[model samples]
Target: MAVQPSRPLRLFADYLRLERVNLTERWMKAVFNDADLSESDRLTHEQLSDHVPEILGEIFSALEDQDLDEVEPSIERNARQHGRLRWKQGYRIDELVRELDLLRQVLMGAIDSFAQGHPTFTRRHEERARHFVDEAISFVTLTSIREVVTERDRKIDEYTGQLERANHELLLKQKLVGELYESRMQITRSVVHDLRNFLNVFAMALQMIARAPARTNAALALANRQAADMKTLVDELVEYSIVLGDNNPLATEAFDLRVLFDELVASCGPAIEAKGLRLVHRFDPQLRTITTNRLKLKQVALNLLTNAAKYTKVGEVELDMRAHGDAHWRLRVSDTGVGICAEDQQRVFREFERANQDDVPGAGLGLAIVSELCRKLHGELRFASHEGEGTTFEITFPLRLDPGG
Candidate 1:
């Protein structure tokens, strides 16, 4: 009723058992010698060799039983462990792939050597052995990659949970602070909803790939892209949360003003170009250095620039910085696009309040954050907008943040 493994297969299994150490040594030598696997140089012998011996034993079991299914679970377990270990050791996926490829080559070479030494090992036996080793190596490669992906998914889920809990706690704190909490709570809800949508898309893509692994490359790429977008949103949410709280104090330092705007322009250049919009910036050549919170100022400028780039479908976004009298400096961001109507002008700085929420892609917190930062910096935030024309936002901050200094 059942077919037993041939004598050659049985003897091959015994050869694997007796030569496991030799096989492992050869693999290690190969890995250490590989230029792409240089990361292995940092690892101790035991760390690099972890779970590999068990994988060889499982390979031996597969050859002995003539059924890969009988030993696959154990193989998977060892392979997963090896994968996680490699990941923690800072191994890139390609490097892990290269490492495993080396192992496959080494094993195939060993199989050929074994065949050459034994007269009983016929051509048919050699082909079968090569097939078995190839199957095991292929399975190992897939399982290792899957385990890494699963780990990444777990981390993203954990981070999203943490952000949700932090937002909840922030809402409670804002509630006790004042009645303004209602508006903030609404903003928080909108942000969470948007984040959940991205996460859902990412999760669905991952599930589809899991179900049909053969068609995973494209789906995996989509998943990674969605994950990246989610991270960007999460970072923005964190910044908004910190701005909402009163605990974060301003850390001011005197830095070159020209250097700051130059960096900001460079950062926003790609996004502006994507929309086919021109970015025009004019900095007063006289303004060499300013004593202020460089990080907060950078954040404020970035938010304003990105907001302009997002809303303006055509024409140019202009950023201007000039001296306002002798006491202060004026920073203006103006965009040629659909402007805020007179009716919606009053609530422009309110949290989660967007005039064209449906037509635009934003959480409606850009101006709100800008308003809060201006208040913290003790500066004035003013804007001029026409219904069908364009909008200009300007902030006038004292030249010296500490008036006494």
Candidate 2:
């Protein structure tokens, strides 16, 4: 992948400030010259460009299309000069904006802490301030350096000369290891492709519903629900990918735990009742509000419930919710059904793994999704079962927002 050059900076005044552009160019050139480079280095060229003409061209194109006076000045001007992109490939444009805002917030926080006499800042105000700024700048530069250079030739040489010799003496399944990672990447690509198609279908469904005559109210309502459900499924897939595919977590909110569980149960109530299965909702009396990604939590709940309904011909599926303290919550989904065997529990959370070779139409992604969600939330997700008796999945999450939550 080739790096796209950045759009140039447009000086607002008659005389442009070349110092900022010159420094930024130097920084970028240094990064590009670094030996340790990654795929991100290639992406920085396209986004956050520094070529004034290309940026101006796009801006003028927009102007020619329709709106002129209302055109965004940032797009047409020196926006690229403000440290264009932190990490081009691994992150999104929106995420970059959010991080920039967060960086500003951290700086504001330091100032606030200094003013409020916060213990560390109060004792060593100047020292802490200097340390934070220095560290932040160093981090920015380090990341920038890694994202602007692709010294593939040198990297291979170094690896071959230093690491290959050491590894050569050891016996290892090199082919298997290489193929396994390739397989995982392929899985990610396929899922992402399917998700995009599904989203487009859902969008088309919404459009159809909107265009339909109002007299077809019943049909429209059903279409709307189906569209919403499909959208939710796509969202679930996206969240699952973020948690597993990208090792990222969903953005969490401090939501009402009781309500969250209630809606989940309510959503699956129809499916449970349709299968002649008894569903129970058990809650802790002392339970309080908790912060979590409601959708992923709901996904885990429903995945368990679906399994419960599918396995047991006769029995109740209990969803038990309890709280430990202001910082922890417990959710147990127990079903009196064909339970997981001891030997299979270890591999159950693995993607595409199943307990037995039964003719089930599942891709074995449910438990995998659950495990990833728990991990992203910095918690525990596990399963316990007695074959032919029952199975229970326990997920413990911090009531507080997790590191990645």
Clashing pairs in 1: none
- Tens digit of per-residue lDDT, candidate 1, span 1-405: 124789988998899899999999999988998888879999888998999899989988888777888889999999998888888888888988898888889888888888888889899888888888899999998899888777777878999999999999999888767756677677678778878887897888888898988869878887887777666666766778889786645677888889988998899888897899999989998787788888788889999998887778889899898888877898999999788999999998887677675446566778888998888777899999996678999999877797334
Off by over 4 Å in 2: 1-243, 246-250, 357-359
What is the overall TM-score of model 2 with all chains considered together? Answer: 0.43
lDDT of each: 0.84, 0.57
Clashes of each: 0, 12
lDDT of 1: 0.84
Q: For model 2, what is the error of residue 263's alpha carbon versus the real structure, in angstroms, after optimal superposition?
A: 0.5
Best by lDDT: 1
Summarize candidate 2's per-residue lDDT along 1-405 as a digit string, tens digits: 112211211111111122334333444454455444333366464353344333333333332232332334443233333333343244444444443334334334434544454333343434433343344333443333443333334556898887877676443667667756875875677567545655675666667667775635665565566556456555655655666665454677877788877887888778877868788889897787677777767777777777677676667888899986667888888888878888887777765565564434344566777776667667777678999898988888788866643
